[model samples]
Target: GESVGLHLPTLSVQEGDNSIINCAYSNSASDYFIWYKQESGKGPQFIIDIRSNMDKRQGQRVTVLLNKTVKHLSLQIAATQPGDSAVYFCAETRGAGNMLTFGGGTRLMVKP
Candidate 1:
């Protein structure tokens, strides 16, 4: 219902630098937030996750910050690389196994 009015697109980013991935969520009641990285022709691999109660969470070379005040979320990647190049996705779940809703998506590119 809420996703029916959302945008489904992909964003491209350059490599060997920092990347900020953004996602717009339609529901304001969501709680659990998970970020995933997917390479071509493969399933998503979990990168990091954060709870609605928390403002920020970090992982290996990646950080996920949630702004409940603005109802927005972001994933920051440090020192992106060609090997790190892949599509990033944000998945929101209200509770355990609550049918995760995915955002548009993001593509990261690395240049030598």
Candidate 2:
């Protein structure tokens, strides 16, 4: 079965440096991708998202990129801060929009 998974389970970065998180999905039919940030004891929050039609999308301090040909997705955080530390996940779903397959998640740690 096709599923989404992260290339790395953990990512460490400096408080003021940039961070990149990678994800791969096996389902080629998925048309939408979303990046979520989950803090301890809290639900995942939407950070950014990109449609399969677009190659890249940017929001505030975050960017999302999609490569359909390679079934790859990436999240880039600029000037990462302590508050930005969390578990990030990538989710994908078909056009139905009723179901979302999530990745294993990657833990982001920021060091001051």
Indicate which candidate wins on lDDT: 2
Each model's TM-score?
0.86, 0.97
lDDT of 1 by residue, 30-101 (tens): 988888899999999999999999999888889999988867888888887777778888888875668788
Over 1-112, each residue of candidate 2 has an lDDT whose tens digit, in order, gives: 9999999999999999999999999999898999999999999998898988999999999999899999999999999999999999999977665488899999999999
Off by over 4 Å in 2: none
Candidate 1, overall lDDT? 0.79
Clashes of 2: 0
Give the candidate number with the greatest TM-score.
2
User: Each candidate: RMSD to true structure?
Assistant: 2.4, 0.8
